[model samples]
Target: MTKIAITGASGFVGQTLAKKLIETSPDAQLILADVHQPPNPTKSSNVECIAADLTEASACQSLVSRSPDAVYILHGIMSSGSEADLELGLKVNFDSVRNLLDTIRVERPATKVIFTSSCAVFGRAAVKDVASEADIVPYPESSYGTQKLMIEFLINDYSRKGLIDGRVVRLPTIFVRAGAPTAAASSFVSGIVREPLHGQESELPVDPNIGIWLSSPRTLAHNLVHAMNVPADKFGHFRTVLLPGYSATSGEILDALEKVAGKEVRSLVKEKRDENIQRVVLSWPAKYDTSRARGLGFTEDVGLEQTIKDFMEADK
Candidate 1:
């Protein structure tokens, strides 16, 4: 069996990825590390859900003891939450990254570490037609982005030193995220559309003109698996490549919603501009030059219309 260790296994994306892994990768053993234990965890036969806070160095050290062939580090502080709690962000997002890397360096240096990064690492400056894996080295705008960028740099530096095998995949904002809305700045993107589509009211935290990159939950999960299994030589010139996503303006969101849910449900979405949310959303990259990733066998999103369809189907 191919043993894999994953942090944030209880999260929306994490849970979805875990379930899919269980169904598809039959020869894979999953080591699930999370803060709270998964309720009724016995349903999964191949998973070992361990309750441990990632902020603690000892917890991380002990968690990495499974000696898995690969590790998927999906844990990180959300953008809005990180901005709200500086101390927590520093300890969890920044410090935990260093601690986790150190643990792998000491105990499991041979294991490949697959990191889930974000497009938010790109700053306000507009790059070429589409941002490439090479463009992620620019200055980041937020503390959360800065933290991710710092970790990417550390991963690259450590890889060069032959400390560990690190691959960071910059994920686009995933739509139709399951569960309660959290502190992520991009949460509102799903919130505004998902809530209204299910015959409920939702608050649009930003204007309709705001443009951002997005992908479906299924695509996000598949991309994670792809990054883990893709040949190491495919990286070519750049180690970290910005994932390609459907570039949609907020206005396009409404159009897509109307097409999927009819005009009646579309009206349920209310526009209330929150400056804090708008600031973060506006700073993200509008598009990415993922030709390198595509040529290397990475996938692109199924467009915005299909993204809405996926959300609608999941809600049913």
Candidate 2:
């Protein structure tokens, strides 16, 4: 059976990805782990759920002791959280990942590792409206983005050395995400819908015209699973792939919500801009030349209106 281990299995995306794997790879052994004990997404006996402090090398060693064929390194602090607490972000995002990589190198040599990164790695100043993986070195403005870039470099070197097979997929903002407001600067992208639906006020921290690249929970999960299944030989010297997503401005997203959920629900959204959040959010590239990733068979999102409609129907 193909054994898979997913760290940060408690988060929204983590839980969604786990469910996708269970549906597609039922016979595979699923190891769900997080600092907070993870609930099995499917509640299936075939899965193993464990609480792990990955910052502690011992916990990482134990997680890899089972020798998973593939590992999804999914845990990290959100953008604003990392920027607010430098030490904490470094510990959780950068240092812990390196610790996990070390353990994987020793115990599960050559195991495929699928890592989640963000589009925030590209600073607005460096990117000339559109970014492709080949043309630029990341110039991250936020601490969180810097941490992701650091980890990406490490993953690339690790893969190059043949220590492990790594695939780093940089993500666009995921909208209509199910859950409470997160520490992510991009959380507002989801909040425009999530809070409004629940009769809570949502804030628009950035200008309405600011563009955001986005995907749905369904698409992100599918692409992540596909990343693990890809042949290692298919990846070039660089291991990172920027996933495909369409760009829409903040006004466009709000309009989509109004179209799907009606004017009443949309009215709950309030404009309460915060400069720090805006600066951090603006650093991310709003559009990418995803031709490389598309050719590799990664999925793109449906339009914003359809995505919002799907969330409303499913969530209600």
Candidate 3:
């Protein structure tokens, strides 16, 4: 049977996307390539885990040996970590991608690739209201965003050469993120509200007025799946497009938190500004046009309140 391969299979987005693929595409097989195995094994026989360090040359080659029909590249370091650990970021985020793409060129040119990029690619918003798919001139202000945009362009160039079918979906900062937080700079966005609601004190890294492009994990998972299945003929060529998201200020996020968690729990969010975090957050697009994604059948979460409710319900 034809298989689907995914890197960063153990990550928040990767794990969620894997479960979604199993539930939605029962017949399709999945080969998970990550340095770590899935925390919870899939009940489906179609899911197989391949724990390998993608940054290593040999490991990447071994992964491509499976010859999957489609591949999902979801691995990357976060902004803070990338800045702190430049070497590690270069290895995992940059070199790993190059090695994997090289392996794909040699081993499986026919494999289609869906890359999960980020809205961080656009360093500044050109307009006050919304950005669009046409505004792809990446002015990445941080190491992580720069690397992601680099790979996105590489994928586009590879597609131009007819090497493989490549698609890039620029994901917004996902909210109500499940599980424990990792190194992501935007982790604090969810953390401030999520932790406080669970009776834990959380720190705010930026001001309440800091607006960002936001989406729910469920919507993010849907978009990743949609990217893989969208008819090739419908897209014209291998392209990169920013997905739709609700443009919400941090105060708006906290307001929703208060409604769901009550006054006492909501008050636990302690503010401590970090200039580094603020610098990064301020550069990102405050809004996006996203009409293209909507026209193409991609949808957004039902508003911030419902997203918070979904997070609470899922935690139960």
Candidate 4:
């Protein structure tokens, strides 16, 4: 049986990914690890849930003791929270990840590790130019981005040394996220669509013309699983792959919402730009040439309107 472990299994993406994995691989044994239990933990006998502090070395050791064949590393501090609290960010994002890596190296060397990174690793320079596989030289603009870059490098080094089979997928800002607002700097990207559709007023933290690189939660979850199935040889030298995404301005997203949900829903979005939010959002690149990920058989969302429609249908 394939044994897999997923950290941050309590979060939205983790929950979705767990479900997807269970559906696709019915016989696979899953160990879901997080500080708090997931809201709807999998009921399947093949799935096991472990609540523990990943920042603690003992907890990390225990989690890896199962010797999972593949581990999905998804835990991290959100962008705004990371920026606001550097110490906390360092502990959760960097320290915890290092602890996990070390534990895996000692206990389960050569195991496949799929890390969920973000486009925030790119900065203002990347924003101005369309980022590609060759162009992604990370000059992080935020504490969160810097931490992710450092982990990417660490994972790469570990992979090169044959300590682990690491696959780093740098995700775009996933939109139409379900649940309450998060401390993520990109939370507004989802809120602007989700809140209005739920008949709630949503705040717009950036200019209407400001564009962002985006993918739907469904697409990201699919790609995460795909990353696991791809052979290690597929990623020759660099294990990092920037996932494919579409670029849309705030105005375009609003227009799509209006077209699908009607003008009433669109009117609920309030223009209240926060400078801090703008600074972080603006630093992220709006466009990417993710042919590399596409070549690897990863998929992309059709358009912004379809993504909004899917969210409405799924949430309602």
Model 3: lDDT of residue 205: 82
Colliding residue pairs in candidate 2: none
Error of 1 at 130 (Å): 3.8
Model 3 ranges with Cα > 4 A deviation: 125-129
lDDT for model 3, on a 0 to 1 scale?
0.83
lDDT of 4 by residue, 1-316 (tens): 9999999999988988898888888888999889986544566798888897999999999989988999999999999899999999999999999999988988889999999998888888777678986776779889999999899999999999999999999998888788889999889989999998888999998999998889987788889999999988888898999998899999999999999999999999999979988888778888999988988889977689889988988896
Q: Name the TM-score of candidate 1.
A: 0.94
Better of 1 and 2 by TM-score: 2
- How many backbone clashes can be found in candidate 1? 2
TM-score, structure 3 vs. true: 0.95
Question: Model-by-model lDDT, in order?
Answer: 0.80, 0.89, 0.83, 0.89
> What 10-residue stretch in candidate 4 is worst by lDDT?
36-45
Clashing pairs in 4: none
| Pairs in steric clash, model 3 | none
The best-first sequence of candidates by TM-score reads 4, 2, 3, 1
Of candidates 4 and 2, the better by lDDT: 4
Runs in model 4 deviating more than 4 A are: 41-43
- Model 2: how far residue 118 lies from native, Å: 1.0
